[model samples]
Target: MIPTNRLSSSRNSRKPVCSRAVSRRGLIVAGLMLGLLGAGSAGAYGLCPGEMENAGRMQQRILREWPLRSSSDPASRFIQQLGVFLAQYGDEGIPWRFSLVRNLAPNAFSIGAGNVFVTEGAITFAQSESELAAIIAHELGHELAGHFCADSYSRGEGDIFMPPSEHYEVGVGSIRQSIDPAKEQQADRIAVSLLQAAGYDPHAMLQVARRLPAGGEVHLHDPRRIHSLERLLAGYPPAGGLPDSLTFKEVRRVIMGETHQR
Candidate 1:
């Protein structure tokens, strides 16, 4: 596990009322899931008891607080399919669940235990399916690397629940847990490998990085991170990967339509 101290401490301390409400709901949902699901063994991930319990709670909280696009929605299905496809190339310890969030921020995050989420903003922001795949692949990298468990353990609090005032900014930013630069680079490397293995244009990772705002609390888009990706991709041939599909275009259109209707 990556050391918890390596995780960045930089975060905005503003908590909106809605965020607090979500925390309360999360606590309630955590209790219900604990009763229904039981605190199973940590299994191969070697998660601590608290980490295992909190993972289920976090998943439930996200589902309850966010308005996920219906599974029947084309955009929702597309993201789920792409995420599952990429996950096949990584760890298989937990069942993966991918869903599109209805929020307008171009964000993606993983809550460990194979749960990944991408927002409608991300679907529209991505120019091609490969770019969106790059995002999902990156989140998979975090999960596969066990960053979540590491961060939770580092807190020494034995709980995966973040402070109520800590809010992960929307858009390509950190999760509720602040991932440090080294871990970010590690995830980026894993993302490129996953993309290559899954037949996505690995350079699409660079393309997405280049388009994001650089240098801020959003370290995910820092120029240093982009350069690291560039170095990582230098050896791979750029052109032979999969092309954008009609389905991707259709999903984008559907998501955009939904966004406009709101």
Candidate 2:
């Protein structure tokens, strides 16, 4: 309903270049073009004129479409706390807001502007805090790396922030976008760093990747992605840095209970 893409790692780009520089350059160019050619021309770069304003509108539109769990819910609070905790190690400029979507599908996604949502099914799917953290961290990676802008430009989608049509379905497959495979791999690498910095077992990301169904347009084939993650993990020491937190266990229990009742 947010008109956003789901999380699934794919493609193997052995070289991890600094994408931030590319993003910044693209934005600057987009800005210049907007000034010269006006708002209509800016869409050529996958940017809406006044991105921050569009982001706000986009967030509002998504909230309207999706049924989010109340913020007061314990499970919702846990997601917020975990997202904020992981965010501290990354970009401090973006005001990251994490929310629990009421959907039962095991998915997570970020609609630009530091907003991340994890479905109830995804929470239940994760076996531990670190695994859940991996999902959140990966979404953060997408935001931090400016994937939304780059992805939009690549596909020539012209303002991905636009509201969805009335006929849109509130299903996982309906909302998921197939991002470039290279960008997906880049996000995976960034998630590893975020997990390590947050004292989570970096391997937790790999674990979740393995559990995901393979050969979807949104995800890389299992073997290639697994091999890439394996190579990346080889650089880190073999220490399980942290265990699942009691908070996550409780939150998962509450969410599972509510899900069953529904």
Candidate 3:
């Protein structure tokens, strides 16, 4: 067990919401701890006793309790088909299953063992099939990379999973942290390559690039707060980066059109 004193000390130095604010970083530590093994046969992602099962429960409740259930439209099914297409190429097709979450939030995320869930709002916001594919492909990329098993460790961070999930708070934190800035960028590069390898349009990723926040341009990236991912997809400072002329503004216009996101 991590020393109580050390945990207290770590908590004291943090901001009021520092636990959450720095949550992503702590998640990284959990993952790095696993790397200490130095070498091994890769285990699995989201196969922990409670990991995927817990996620299923969480999602099921959301469907039951939330007033905003996803639409049962054909478009949603179509989106699922697109996801299925991209998933077959993933390293974990048998274990992974794709689902479209009927929520609005313009968010897309995945749980290990092939659980790729994309929000309805994110899909509605997408201008085309390829654009949607870009987001799904990116999340799928993380699952295929074995980020879950990579982050799981006896680091004793107590499994930072969200409350009631039998995971340490730190274990949950490390999930997002598994891919650091460098690893994140590498993942994006790999996402694009994977999408292309699967015969999707390479430039389809540009739509996601354009949809990123404007503040990101200053960093020479797609400023969506996913810094590592943005820089990788935006590609900059040479080294096979995107052509210098492709600006965020151009991409933004295509995604935003005359209407702006509030």
Candidate 4:
């Protein structure tokens, strides 16, 4: 973890990373290498605390126990870039490590402090970049909100995606439940704000809610979730923002083996 920098230059005047709009997303993706600077400055943002050594140690443990897939893959790098970009708006104290796992279940989770892991299935299932980014934003919301800082999870020290608790914080000796319903809603709300503020279409979250199947790891039920999300964005319907990327499509093609030859 290092110093942190502001995501936009000033709320009013944002400097796009590219001269051409088509490559703007690519530029943002590349700019993340230096995005983690300017620590202790986001007080108004309240992203994270100034120190996170404890959370850092836990992140190491999770990385050690679980085999992480290489992020060199374009699709994987895209996901990492999304997380890093969203993170730039959060606390700099958080290292914000992103990883792609081999699991088939469409799941995403964050643990310790700033570790966000997305499953291969999630990538394959997401129809567009916005839908995928919405999911990532939700998971990152969990980390930013300090849900993992719960006393039970802090010492439990078990794999987060397991039965009982399942996908994003299972219990150790005992079977503690998964993330609280209230917390899920809170994350959803926070995610919308984060996505919108980051120049992403907030309604993309609603699109994801419709695509997900019922049950395991799907919180708040789709219809209800959709209603709430729609209301939240009612005031701010989609306007110009980040668009679906060919990079995302190509990544999907490589992972899903679907030809874009047409």
Candidate 5:
């Protein structure tokens, strides 16, 4: 990546401002979370990190074999680049990485650490930079919140909706496997804060949410992209010109490829 720039400003106040009036569950660093996570969690949640790393490596190879409609997919590249901004440079830990997978389902998901995957359908479905990033940030919240680590124990208690199911690292610190409606809501709240903290517009995050297939029932065979979107904002689309809320510099920088170092 080109010389990295700060996510908040040129301008990374890695020490998150406690007075930002963060939402109840905003994804803020209590203090250098990523650094601390890297240091500890060696014995407990360590397996989660290993699982994430393995998933990332596997997806990278899968993308290598994906058949793209064309060689140039700026939006796809944008997703990858933005991911580097949020996961690598950001203070929040549990490193995230991005990849595009060939699928018709308009969806995306992050498993393990920073392992986020966007289906071809999703890329084709998104109209602008914000929709794609909204999906990505939501998934990132799951990874950061340690949602994947639940697979191991959840298998005995109930069904888990994850792939490479049996590979859940046992050594990882135990994260709650509650699939309760409340937890889903909590994850969504975190996504909103994460996107905002990363300088992506939260309203756009809602756009991705409204476009999702909605109803009282959730599909079993279908992926959870929209469900995840709904969780992020409880089915409300970001109103007004969310673009107006973006930091002028961050928006210009991302649009101009000033931060496409990845």
Candidate 6:
């Protein structure tokens, strides 16, 4: 009888202990979530759990399938240099990579592991160096903030910044949809900051926004986004900075076929 009573007392004592443990765990999880929200607001990019482990492997696999334009090409080199300059402000110790794709669609995307890619059409579409930098900066922002990694898990695939084969009715009709509204805004904000830090006019982003064709190969027209960009640019009025250089002009001339060189 005494042993039975002792057993009951022991079980009762453990009940409060178990409850306390669960409560502590819940508080810890809540704290972590709050911290993540705070970081997001501060423009600090945080990867999802276990993302760092798989990002490299996934990036390598995707690069194999994606046709990469040769880095030795003059046009490709020009884009790469611009992307590298913008990427310098990203996370340290990360090996930043840039590639210019051969596709003519005005699209740019970033996979994980600091790998950023721009289509030839994007370069041809930009009116100025700042405009092109704006596009690259936006993709860099996506990579820095780990949006691509999060998107990959959500969609259960390697490439999250592109649409599926079925969605392709014509040339890159669905590529723009890969970036949802919230992520796009977040990336834009980050890109603007990066551009400003790199001595590029933030207003150049607005110019590109205005230039993008409505329902075109690149991003479709979003009035809300345009309004937001306008507001952001208003904060940074245009001042003289890095405008189109001779090198940039040469690259554009070659890309547009305005000059033919053997």
2 or 5, greater by TM-score: 2
lDDT of 5 by residue, 7-94 (tens): 2221222222221213112224431244332121211112242454445444554456554333245545656776665443223334
- Local distance difference test, each candidate: 0.64, 0.65, 0.45, 0.60, 0.45, 0.60
Worst 10 residues of 2 by lDDT: 1-10
Q: lDDT per residue, candidate 3, 94-113, as tens digits?
A: 26556655455566666554
Query: In candidate 3, what residue range of length 10 has the lowest lDDT sum?
Result: 36-45
Clash count, candidate 4: 7
- Number of clashing pairs per prediction, in order: 0, 1, 16, 7, 5, 0
Poorest stretch of ten by lDDT in candidate 5: 37-46
Ranked by TM-score, top first = 2, 1, 6, 4, 5, 3
Q: What are the TM-scores, per candidate, against the unseen true structure? A: 0.71, 0.72, 0.51, 0.68, 0.52, 0.68
Weakest 10 consecutive residues of candidate 4 by summed lDDT = 38-47
Best by TM-score: 2
Q: TM-score of the candidate numbered 5?
A: 0.52
Over 22-57, each residue of candidate 1 has an lDDT whose tens digit, in order, gives 332232234234432112111123222344555677
lDDT of 2 by residue, 1-262 (tens): 0101211112122113344425433432443434421121111112222444545655676677789999998899999999988765554445678989898877788876678888888899898889999989888777766665532432332335232342111224334454454556677877777687678999998988888865432343456667788999998788596887898988899888988999
Q: Which lDDT value does model 2 have at 202?
A: 91
Can you tell me which runs of candidate 1 are displaced by over 4 Å?
A: 1-50, 150-175, 214-220
Prediction 4 TM-score vs. true:
0.68
Model 3 stretches astray by more than 4 angstroms: 1-54, 57-73, 150-179, 214-262
Clash list (residue pairs), candidate 6: none
